[model samples]
Target: MAAMLFGGLLASNPAEAATAVSSVTVTSVNSGDITASVEGKSELAEFGEAVRDEAPELAARSVSDLAVDYRVLKVDMKQVRAQFAPGVACVDGDGNSRAEDVIVAPRNAENIRYELSGDAQRDPNYDPAKQGNRCDPDLFWDEGASPEVDDDPAASAPVRPYTEKYASACFARKSQWKDIYGIYLEVSYNDSCWSDYVTKYDGNSSWNYYSVKAPSSCHIARGTYLTSCGHGVERNAAKGPVVKWDDWAPAADSNGDCRDKGISVSVGPLSVGGSYTHCEKQNIYKYAEDGKMSSYWKGKVTGTRATQHQVSVRVAQNAGRPRWTHWINSDACVCYK
Candidate 1:
């Protein structure tokens, strides 16, 4: 069951030293009696099979709980493109284009940015002499990166940032997305997916520029097999919370046709609706054979202080990092987006 708890009311900006609290209306659209429709349940099962086809190690285990949630959203890729750093479309050395893997955050896979060490001078955990860690590939923390496991939660937490241009990204985080039926993935608390995000992504942000737009036959298979099929929609669900595995946009249809391979999809008037139905069992471990799913949504995001909650990230000291370093963030680098 998705409990209605407060999403972290963070500072207005990530790198800020002081943390403040404010009472705002952060609500979940749909509430109790959440049940996964038979169709929804079937979708989960099929996704499990697809995953098994890809990664067999995690075959179906006896599940204690499972529920698939849904969200009806109007995705504006142009808006998404505005928020993250710029990226280029290039293929890999193997002749396979999987370059988006290098991005720190899939939403904005290229041109990742964060607070420089010099900006944290006032921070109690800030240090002057530290190892030189580069952001060319892989996101590394000096110390105290994981809040739940870290010795000092105040010192740092898993940080996700939007570009300065698009500050007010996920401001009014909907505690529950009303229209959907599924369980709330406590993504921030989950250890497995969060770690997977760090390992798979954060490499190099270059991919071959080609439209693998949805193929005619959209084969719903498992595994991270993305292709240059139909024009694809790349989205990073709940970016700040965690790099959720379930939020991945399905691979382009293989048949060179936009038809889903006999799968039921929620069709909106605008034609953008699918992530709400598909769920990879691996990402969502809490499985319930029979139950309802709920949703979370926040709207009217703008690049402003009133509309945003800030999240900051720092390195864990133990991992090749001392205390501090020498670098500065541009004034433009600070914003609510």
Candidate 2:
């Protein structure tokens, strides 16, 4: 009113609109682009909602944070938390690393996982953290000669971990009675050991076995702490022994040594009974000619050398039980001492 003069200017051309927009400097770049205040909008939430509802696909295409898909706003935190609870990693076997994701065979997974990590409570082959069977099952030691828990004979026996997949002990077998069950053990380091463990579907089924021959000389003697149990079959003059063993120190015994970088077992025509033959040792120098010192056990000594030898034990099919021999390192044998 004092000057009684007023003038109004409106944007009439694209150049004018651009000049007006340039006049207002952008304070910040939100999301991937600059964000500006919209006229007459107290809060940006309402405008964002309208844009998303009208052009959902377009809104999903981000242009700064000013516009976003309704899906983003509708995230369920609880669902997301459950999805990533335990971290996941990938592994491959079957000699293929780039195959499509498949549900791992739980049975094999349980064994492989336990072999990699499981609690081995007893059994000389046991390692609490590293659960490879360091000792062979057939190479058991005399209870009086080895370690025990509270003098409990049963406790000292190796405790096989319960397999999560099979819902039973890692070692399981079918029983004599079709419906009954039994535990399985691997002696020759093969699944054939399970043959006797599984229930027989037919009554006249025959039993097949895999056996190892004793060494000719004691590879593992009293003083040899690094020695482990091995197996080979002693054959006639023209035939050779079938050798299978674990050379890995921690698992050189009957139980498979799982920790060794590279370990394997082999089977051949080695007879357990053929291992021990003509096995006699005499410290003749210590005793006179009339009194010859000799050591003997109930078996044949097939072959012998200064520090290595092979002995044989009989596998009698008596008491309806299959008897097997312990092809052990001399240090692991209690028969001599």
Q: After superposition, how far is residue 232 of candidate 2 from its true place, in Å?
A: 13
Candidate 2 residue 229 C-alpha distance from true site, Å = 12
lDDT of 2 by residue, 157-252 (tens): 454322111111101100010011221111111000001111111121232122221221222222212112222212121211222231111112
TM-score of each: 0.20, 0.14
Candidate 2 whole-model C-alpha lDDT, 0 to 1: 0.18
How far in Å is the alpha carbon of 233 misplaced in model 2?
13
Error of 2 at 180 (Å): 58
Error of 1 at 276 (Å): 27
